[model samples]
Target chain A: MGIKINVERTSAPKEKPEISQLGFGKFFTDHMFIMDYDSGEGWHHPRIVPYQQILMDPAAKVFHYGQTVFEGMKAYKTPDGRILMFRPYKNLQRLNRSNTRLSIPSLDEGLVMEALKQLIKVDEDWIPSELGTSLYIRPFVIATQATLGVSPSEKYHFMIILSPVGSYYEEGINPVSIYVESEYVRAVTGGVGNAKTGGNYAAGLKAQQEATEKGYSQVLWLDGVHRKYIEEVGSMNVFFKIGNKVVTPALNGSILEGVTRDSVIRVLRHWNIEVEEKTISIDELVAAYRSGTLEEAFGTGTAAVISPIGELNWQGDKLSLNGGRTGPLASKVYDFLTGVQRGTVEDPFGWIEKV
Target chain B: MGIKINVERTSAPKEKPEISQLGFGKFFTDHMFIMDYDSGEGWHHPRIVPYQQILMDPAAKVFHYGQTVFEGMKAYKTPDGRILMFRPYKNLQRLNRSNTRLSIPSLDEGLVMEALKQLIKVDEDWIPSELGTSLYIRPFVIATQATLGVSPSEKYHFMIILSPVGSYYEEGINPVSIYVESEYVRAVTGGVGNAKTGGNYAAGLKAQQEATEKGYSQVLWLDGVHRKYIEEVGSMNVFFKIGNKVVTPALNGSILEGVTRDSVIRVLRHWNIEVEEKTISIDELVAAYRSGTLEEAFGTGTAAVISPIGELNWQGDKLSLNGGRTGPLASKVYDFLTGVQRGTVEDPFGWIEKV
Candidate 1:
């Protein structure tokens, strides 16, 4: 963990974009963190260099075999110039978990954590100060071995790039219409779905495209083995509030163990709210809706934190929740969570890390 | 379809490796094919240039979202100094099919096929003349857009690289040991399993490594739902010769329709052999083995043509097929298929195309 990191700043620093107009993952900062991994040499040559193009062989394993893993986190800039990251250690741990599943070499979490903090401090000015805006941190690893063989690559690149994102909902908290995807399966029990790899996201793209074309914001995925039990919504963890109890899908092998999902459940339990992780089927949800007890539905992730589900279009039936508006519990969770992330509220659970 | 392809000769040609030492997808040729695709402009700028490293952005969609597809084929140099490729059109078609599933833009198959022929002719000297040896052609498409969004990329690079190879079996086609996996799931019916994409291969690496460590060459995957029906074996279509009936897994949504697989079935039928495509289960296969009617088993793909299965280890039980030797049917299929590819036998089905 005491590895020396070489720092090479860019000679010509480009002007920063208008923070208000910077959408998600569009504008990058001036510098990035780069590290290399060889089979025998292990992960070495950790450095911070100017953000630039990566020269790779056309036959690199990631290009042809999808041997890559990534993690998404956000950094917030408070009014007092404090930089805050939510449960960064958890994200890095998940990165290693993903690496194990994809057969990629693991990175020393402590070393990577130190490098990430240094990179953030180098370009802390790139962090947006808007109410909901933050610096999006994308840490990814790609197989770089240039051989067209179906095996784990012996070489890889671990990189961290930053982008300034605008407020998730600039206007206000809005619940989106979600279509329950019935056709395309994202992941199964014995698949790479739970791992934070590119393949799981690739499997969901077609379904998202179809749902968007049908005037839905995202598609709620059902379990692969049974096309009834709820799995996830879009790329985020989903939760439903039925009657007086709130429930979310259990962390089955095929479901991503989202950090936000865990934080949400913790916060709910801290407030003495019943948050059960259970296998809730679509039929049960529809029945609850018919009985007028389906109160609210929402998705949790780093991007939105809390994306309320206002309308659900499943098969040929349509169900509206909370009269197609943001539910009270969703609004409370959003405000409290964002407030904690941005350092405007108390952090009783030690989820915030200062850089 | 009628696009003009610009050819650029390399100033420095690489020294060709020893034909006998060429193992699989190593030692690429001098020239390679390149093309570009954009959302609005479609596919353009087809050219044949020196085989070199491709410079891509670190944040390219392919690196983060696994938005890529690829195809594999082989070219052989016959004794008459003629170059012949097997079922190229089919590979290109499957490439487009993969692109559609991954939400990438479609490529013009005719244009790609023309460029491929021109490129192969330019590098025809690299083809090896050894028995069972051929030039491995890898055509792949990568998403080049430097955005970290979850959607498909707007820009892409479609390139074809050729690698000189030794025979799949430098010694002889000795049947391999296989482990019938019950833990990992490769693909499901409503997923991208049918597509020739990197994600599918990436999902199989863990199981393959485990099998190899346990003294097995490959692992046989079962259905995601039932986990009993045989789906595929080591990224190839599988067949079982039970009694007088030879059967392969039907082309269900989760199974890839391999070009070699189709060719094998056709040649077997042409010889008046009864080849049935059915949903065969592992239990059924084990039952047949118990009754001593599991005459032969093998896998078909671009690399091996026909890889006989000598032993299958499933759930701590071993089922040795054909007394741990290559069966007559598997040997016959290999002889006829490789013979046709090498132009030593009659091409009655017209599978070969001269370069």
Candidate 2:
């Protein structure tokens, strides 16, 4: 169904800085989109209001029960100067999936798409034209009912905010060392692990700090059972390249079904490379490393795009992969994914949505 | 180190209703205790502000990274017209434990105690005098940093909000049916499951819902490693009484060290009841039930001080406990604990703190 759209503008920022110096999630555009849902009156008061702090009761359910869900995508300024979004439909689908898991109400996908387009058009100037830079769009839903009961909230709020961001990695695509936390399980079967909710990231902060203190960049969480099988990192999906065959952990109910992960698999298939999504345990990986068959490892996500995993430290044992740098497969995957996202490569699957 | 607490009071509710009509966390006291902490400033800005909505950034670190901690305790109006808290120091100690685990800064316990005293003195009328009624105090700490990076926040806000809560079991104290979630794990060895953070509750919501959908009141989570050992139920520490011996799951790295759990052990030892805080698996409990040795099963926490477990459904197998209602041991334990909380019993351990 088509969604009714409205726009309310805000006074422009006093000074819009040059796009090169902009940071991630630091600056907001002129407007934000919001809608409310109640048990009696379903989904009322949709508006594009001025960007500002949200006034919330100190006892909001989102703060207590963590009843929240979010989506992250970018509005890229193409060479032709037109604003666009990569796989907007995928983001919409994943947002609904997250809502279902979190017990929050889901909006119509078509309405979300239309509202996103309206918001992007109203704040089109926020889109940066610099290479590898774009306006990040964050659409999140929270339980806004003023009650402290543990069950699901009867009322909710859906809001979208925009921020201009430069490249994630300041350096030119440097490889990262990741810490393997075998004792901590990020997700478990029958848990809300496959959803894009805020709690998943919140649960990973301690491990992330441990990795940072150990001079690693990110954490690699293992399966809840056994704690040996490879699971996705909290922020990104992981992939391993052993010789010519590519393998990733199967979506074992606890791993998120990432949009970029799907795209990567599709691209690999298009290139006629063998892509396997199955359970790959660390023991197998270690044996492969010893035999010199594990050629490369990389992480995939919206923010990081593709991150090369050079070395992994688990239980005081460090294993270096592909000479501690980005390997051939990782480099090619990076260039190809970035090219597709930036509209520099031919769109074979019509994943780009023009705004 | 003394704190100069300046209590600014607000008008109470227009008409104080009877304690029976009170709901869970709906109505609150007039004033709230708040303090701020910063990297350089340390803990400052201690004030009693009118209970109002807080203007928070949409990208606050607590909303994104779950850098939040909370403690749950109650204020009881004794028969002799005294407002008291059941071992407030225990809550302070547990709050510090949770804060340290989540990387959130800790507060001075004495300062926290003084703040509570000032707050209760200002709103003492909110404490209910009826049996099993209480003024639930929720002391929560949240990261107020505006940035979105996945790390500990530099600034924090600590606030205590009070609500009049009626009895948890409106149908009178009775046993509840629980679903044994053998497939899902609440926490891992190195995980933040033991901490009272939003993430652990968020991760447990789906399983709780699943259990509720299957006609159970709560989900009994298992250890992350083997999913065989019992962890906790909903938000309480569990105990199994077999052959006149009280056995609870040991305080493993992943299990929360609950205040009630400690108190129960202390009381049992005082009453000459054998108690052990050792690992108790589901298989052993089921076997005891089969052999007719399991006398009683109960859960203890701030809310629902002692909840009897009537039945257990584990992986399509059902086991019934003694007397589908409150057992003798559970009743005695519940009454004795509430007696100490309400100041009807002598506090040999000096657990009660009068506000």
Candidate 3:
């Protein structure tokens, strides 16, 4: 259940790049952490190897069958220069949940945590100090067995790579316009929707591209059954505010149970706000928006804690909420979440893990 | 658009194995074909390298984004001892169609054919001589750029591998019972439903596993909107015989335009059978089955020429079709397709292409 590390080091970057100029997932650190697992041998050969090419056969299961899963989280740099990683164990648990759905082997959480700590410990300088900027951590597992049959692979590889990233909203936190896709479905029941797997993102890419083409920021995918109920956005869980109640789509096995989403629920509950998890249909939301009762809407994820949604275009009908900007509840939630991450607020839940 | 080959040959197998004992996608030949493409330099450095592991960055885009596509076709040994591939150009066209959906660059069909010819000439001994056995060819393209971003990849790699395969049905073309999955959707309209990409197959694997768990061979997916219209079975196109009409689902974007499906349509039309492509819902199929008008039901694909469906279990109700064996229409269609593929019958449509 534990990892075995074989350590290797690399020279740091010669020129420390500016955090503001950093793009998403382009530049990597000097080293990466890796672990391998087979059916017979559980987990072995954990190492902090130099960031380099990994040799794999063309027929490897990941290439053909897409039996791969990944997690996205960030390590924050506090004002006092102390680095903190937010709830890494939650990410590892979600990774295992994704593994069960894809039929890939799962490694122990302690092993993954140790691997992340080792990598971060070795490459701490890569963490950005900007207000919204931090070191983006990507941990992924892939099926590596060289076979071409349409089944899961017996051998797997898990690796973690770090990249310095700036704020996702470069133009400040303005509410965005999203397209409601009624014709396309991202994930369905009994599918790998709840799992943060590559297929879910892959299925949403075309629709997302369509949204981009149609002059929207992202796509809001509806359920496959009736194309009426709201499921989720492309990579984030959705939350809607109508009057005083905050409602979201229930965890119906087809929508990813985002870590940020769960945290928002806990934080809102702590604040004594009425939070409800139930079936939220598009028709009802449209009616609420038309009646001027839908206070605000936003998306939650690790990349951006809260992205306010000000407009939605569902099948050629346009609707706006809160006058195309952040609403009262959205601002409060964003401030609270970011404040906790940046160590500006009280830490009652101990959500931040100091390294 | 063109490939430049650098041939590096490896020693052949110690001894040629019997073709009858060959399995599917397990054994490979000595040398494999490789090619590379970039936006700045286009395609360059094509090679017949040894079948080996591909060294790639752990954060490669293919692993994270599932931006991958593949084509599956086979090369056959003629009775005259000359090796030929069936519909190679069709595979190339389908590969490009897949590329358009994945936003990857397309390779020239002529270059692909030439490279495949050179590789087949080198590994001619790997082609099985048995009646139902042949050399299975897999050509795949993957995003190889070392980035973790969500946008399209700037660099890609295309490679081809060959494996000797026996019959797809081990029990000698036994009719299989299928489960109609109403809750799960494989592909939807305006999605990558028609592309030969990794995401579609990944989505189907879960349904396939569920069918297997429920004592069925495969799961039949319905239309995403209504969940009542019959779309397809896992990895195959569906066909039904109601009275004198040979009804199949239309070529909707949510359904793959299978090459075998096209051939069957052409053959049925040529034979003057009342073949129609329209939406066939589950309720209509159930009514037909009950009224004794559902003469036969079968699934068509490249793996199994035409597999008969004995029973369909929809929502816990098992509806038996024509007994648990091959029907007259299925046998005729199977014989016609196999004969054309084996070069034993006249190919009036000129669908078969010689390597």
- What is each predicted model's overall lDDT from 0 to 1? 0.91, 0.82, 0.84
Expressed as tens digits, the lDDT of each residue in A1-355 for candidate 1 is 5668999999988799986668678789999999999999999999999999988988899999999999999999999999999999999999999999999988999998899999999998889888878999999999999887688999999999999987454333688999999999999999998999989888999999999899888899998898889999999999999989999999999999999999999999999999999999999999999999999999999877899999999897989899999999999999899999999999999999998
| Position B289, candidate 2: lDDT | 89
- The TM-score of candidate 1 is 0.99
Candidate 3 lDDT over B1-355, as tens digits, reads: 3446678888645355576666667777887899999999887788897788788988788899898999888887878887766677888999998888777888988888888988888888778777777788899998888877676678899999988888665554668899999766777776677888887777777677778889898889998767788999878899999999999999988798888888888899999998999999999999999899998899988777688998899889988887777888998988887777777778788776676
User: Residue B331 error for model 1, in Å?
Assistant: 1.1
lDDT of 1 by residue, B94-124 (tens): 9999989999888888888898899999998
What DockQ number belongs to candidate 1? 0.84
Q: lDDT score, residue A175, model 1?
A: 87
In angstroms, the error of model 1 at B39 is 1.5
Q: What stretches of model 1 exceed 4 Å from their correct place?
A: A168-172, B169-172
Q: What are the per-residue Cα lDDT tens digits for candidate 2 across B1-355? A: 3778667666544366667678677778788898999999988888887777888877777766667788889999999899889889989998998888877788999998888888887888878888878888888888888765567788888988888888665544789988999765677766777888776776777778789899998888888767789989878899989997999999887778888999999999999999988888889988998899998888888877898998889888877888676789999989898998899987888888888
lDDT for A254 (candidate 3) = 86
The residue-by-residue lDDT of candidate 2 on A136-230, one tens digit each, is: 88888887776665677788888888888876655546778888887666777666778877667767777787788989888898887688889
Candidate 2 C-alpha error for residue B194, in Å: 0.5
What is the lDDT, from 0 to 100, of the residue B75 in candidate 2?
A: 91
Model 2: residues with Cα > 4 Å off, grouped in runs: A12-14, B11-15, B315-318
Local error of candidate 2 at residue A250 (angstroms): 1.5
